[model samples]
Target: MSLAETGISDAPLILGSHTLRSRLIVGTGKYDTLELMQQSLEASGSECVTVAVRRERLYDPTGRNLLDYIDFHRYTLLPNTAGCYNAKDAVRTAKLGREILLGLENPGADWVKLEVLADTKTLLPDPVETVLACEQLVELGFQVLCYTTDDPVIAKRLKQVGATAVMPAGSPIGSGQGILNPNNIRICLEYLKGEDPDYPVIVDAGVGTASDVAFAMELGVDGVLLNTAIAHARDPVRMAHAMRHATEAGRLAFQSGRIPRRLYASASSPEDGVIGRTRQDRTSQ
Candidate 1:
């Protein structure tokens, strides 16, 4: 059946306990101002957003928090462990995020985006520490959406440790290099989805622009999570709008099934319908 008839175009993305209509998951960081961030979020059409777990600004008596501007009812708040360099730190930050979300009465308070980096230079996740954190978090009853490298074995290990979603990096965080290794990303998706067709594989980083997001979606990833691509753009709000459309267009194209690659050219106009050329004349020529 055609994609239009199959209704895949209108399908909602199911991630763990949440069903989101929009596949784009943006971050709340690096924006010039909170108001601009809110405006960009509204323009992106994202149903879920990621926020880092950090200290409360209790020092400033009149200071407002990020949650003050965001409406929790409309968007799912996915708290992430951004600056943690080890499993212990990541676990502690995740627990703190849960506590903060619970205090705010957010619906998906138990869900945390886990990122345990190896160092500050590359910002690449440590596979060993990530697996350990995932196992501990799962045991602690947190729905873990793990940020990992593009290694298929590590992806499986994360899934095996009871992670809800395996988020493989398209490149380093905030690099804006786009998908540096599409082959590795594709292999990860294929291996993970082959195990469970409904499993969520979100491309978590290195999306420089709309085409980068589209390329990830075309590889059949369930979602795309990015920050710098939109937050660092010259016009963040406009880039958000572009991302919304790009994701939808890419998803539809994937569902439609593209034509197979070929070395030779195929003509659009029929050779049989030429008015000036008869069968004998064409053969003789």
Candidate 2:
């Protein structure tokens, strides 16, 4: 069935307490300016945006804060632990994010995007540290969206540890490799959502363009989380618009169901019915 026939609310992406309409989650980093970021975000049609708790000026003393530009009511402020290299630091950052946002009247204040990197050079997530931090954050009453490698075992582990969402990277951070191992991603999705089909398995990072985002969505992931791809584009706003449509298109194609491939070609016209030749013509020939 077509998505239009089913409707927009047919399968909403539910993260924590929020039911999000848009599947694409953008990041509020790497943009040249706040104004540009706002424009791009609007164009992207993203309901949730990740903001680095460490880098953003949540409360600027000079009356110039990142929060000043963002409309808290319009978008979900998903605070992330981007720079943390260990479980302790990541947990600390998450706590700080909660403390900072609890004062604000936003529903996403309790949710955190957890990432514990092994090193700066690789920018790959530390599986052990990520799982550890997720456990602590879940215990602390925070809805944790874990960013980890595309490993089925680790994804299941994260879910077991109470991660609200399992975001497996398409590739290394900032590499833009774009789903280096689709098979691995598929496995992660299957294992995590084996029993619960609605389980959120988002593809985070390594998306270089609109096609990449579409492809990821085609894989039946619940959603996508990206930053640099749009932020670094020459025309960020236009790219954001493309991504928005691409995500919808990909999702619609998946829902509509694609036909299976065959080794031999099949004729569209009926073999029993003839348009140009009749029985008399065949006998004369």
Give stretches of model 2 more than 4 Å off.
1-9, 55-63, 268-285
RMSD of each: 2.8, 3.6
Per-residue alpha-carbon lDDT of model 2 for 1-285, expressed as tens digits?
734677654478897777999999999899999999999999999999998876555666686678888999888899999999999999999999888778777777899999999988989999999999999999999999999999999999999999999999999887888999999999998999989988899999999998998899988998899999999999999999989988898887778788898998887987566878888886785
lDDT (C-alpha) at residue 61 in model 1: 69
Q: List the residue pairs that clash in candidate 1.
A: none
Which candidate has the highest lDDT of all?
A: 1
Q: Which stretches of candidate 1 lie over 4 Å from their true place?
A: 1-9, 275-285
Clashes of each: 0, 0
Model 1, 23-51: lDDT tens digits are 99999999999999999999999989999
lDDT values of the candidates?
0.92, 0.90
